[model samples]
Target: MSSNIQIHDIVITEQLSDRSYRNRNADLEKQAFQQLAKQSSYGAQAILNALCDLTLSLCDADSSGVSLLQVVDGEDGFTWNAMAGSMASYVGGRAPRHHSPCGYCLERGAAQLYSYPERFFEWMRLVGKPIVEGMVIPLYGKDKNAIGTIWMISHRDGHQFDRYDLQIISIFANHASAALRMQELY
Candidate 1:
């Protein structure tokens, strides 16, 4: 474990409003599905990349990516599998599992909302983009264990995400889970 890491037990996952999200755009959802279906043939990586792009467009996020839990340097960590928007250059980056927002999302077993995550995650500072608000949805594999997370970030401070944004990301997370499971099989 890196000695410089800090574990901030901040509970960023709030009880988001349970009210049915009314702002969903049916045409956009349909388009995202179509895009994902088309990418499936290109393999999991393609599907993940398409998912990131779709997330950026659908949620109007400054950056979006998938973080998959895996062993890195003999320790458990999360790898940025795919990315889009401003953070796309970090597609292959890695961070310790226990110290990241994705780990907290997996632990809560729900979508998490982070405000100024770099304050808690020191590694995020290295990305060079300050995350104002971020949303993370847990991704599960075939055994139903959390295998990773899908996250979106708003670099603009005061950019708030409502239930509609949460719903959209949750839907995409479901697709991401299926893609990961298929990836496990192959």
Candidate 2:
């Protein structure tokens, strides 16, 4: 634990709306999917990068990134495989699978909105700047296995997310999943 870290013992959630908020942003939802469709011509890395970008825009988030699960020496964890916006400095970083939000999303196998994510994993507080709100969607591999999670976070107050944003992020995650399986840009 870093001495510079602080815990408020409080959670902040302001803009979280009802699950039916999807109906409010119908046109924006369609625009997001259509833009993602046009991103198909690019390679895996490019696609992931674009997906991150789309996540930031579509979700109206301060930051967005994909954390891919990785195993080293049999110790399982996640790596910030790709990122965009505010938290981008943590790109290529590692987080424990047991207490990480991305890990929780993967385990749940569903999209989730996390309020004040740092409370779940204190290490997230060790990063440069913590995100107050996060929406994460699981990413799948060719075998239909969960490989990672694509998430968007907002560092600013009064900028929370809803189900519609989750759906939009899911669209890009699905595209990244299939594209990653089909192409190996490594």
Candidate 3:
């Protein structure tokens, strides 16, 4: 064979564009929420587990956690019910009801997003640990009282959450608030 090389021109066509990909993902997310909405709350524990799983799935977060604070009669502060997380290790024990970002969110009655790593330094200072990024959405009951919050931490190297993620998680938080209220009532 002759010692010669031939090069062929190549043309790349963009078929599945960004818009189509986003639409597909949105459709899938909607379907997932619909399924979660159908799950019946057989018991309190079952309901909490379902809500945690749904919130985690909807937000596409690596770990999902719920921290509930209830005002105890005659107490100067609130009490933490269950501080649960998808990663059991992260929730080794109960979280304090004060001096934490999640508590700040509860007190402020607003959803807060911590995109920068340094924002968690205070928490690190307290626990001697570090968190990469997180989002916290306050849960409110039908009375609109700030009762609890849903916290999510992203996986290492995962993309930081955006507005869309916040919106989706807000919806999940709304449902979670209702569930928490129902549990408290009955």
Candidate 4:
């Protein structure tokens, strides 16, 4: 008896894409909600402050801040409402509505990280130094439209953001959006 073997061609494909951010911490989520409930009673600004403080700790970034859409002298822009950590120096800084990192995040309706975003902004650095690394999450208001963004920043050279950081900051963004919507009501 004779046996025959057959060989077939094999094809392989390689694709590279950015990593998706997804982190779910039950305890953290519960804690965040509880805090958001309390802060909501005070106002959106208070909630933003809480979120900024939490973002700094959650992402372990050098700094964290919240920017809200604003109109100043017939000009549209973003303004720092809450700031923590190293970037707190610019708590009241303003940036042009367009061509700003916050605008980018809002337009994309996503979370992202970048380095030295202030270089491309016309109104950034109104109070503090240029950012080294930044994480931005868009905030949607009651209308479900992007009103601004909440972000985390790192001034150090070696601190790079990862998927985990993005996911955690996203959680904060969710809560911030709700709070902002509540603020809009009052």
Tell me how far the alpha carbon of residue 94 in candidate 4 is from the true structure, in angstroms, after superposition.
0.9
Q: How far is candidate 1 from the true structure (C-alpha RMSD, Å)?
A: 3.3
- How do these models rank on lDDT, best leading? 1, 2, 4, 3
lDDT of each: 0.82, 0.75, 0.55, 0.70
Off by over 4 Å in 4: 1-29, 122-130
Q: Evaluate model 4: give its TM-score.
A: 0.77
The TM-score values for the models, in the order shown, are 0.88, 0.81, 0.67, 0.77
Tens digits of per-residue lDDT, candidate 1, 104-171, equal: 88887888887777777777888887888888888888778888889999999766677888888788
Of 2 and 3, the candidate ahead on lDDT is: 2
lDDT by residue (tens digit), candidate 3, 57-104: 665666666666644554333333333344635442344456455665
Descending-TM-score candidate ranking: 1, 2, 4, 3
TM-score of 3: 0.67
Answer with 3 or 4, whichever has the higher lDDT. Answer: 4
After superposition, which runs of candidate 1 have C-alpha atoms over 4 Å from their true positions? 1-12, 18-22
In model 2, the worst 10-residue window by lDDT is 5-14
Which portions of model 3 miss their true places by more than 4 Å? Answer: 1-26, 70-86, 90-92, 116-130, 184-186
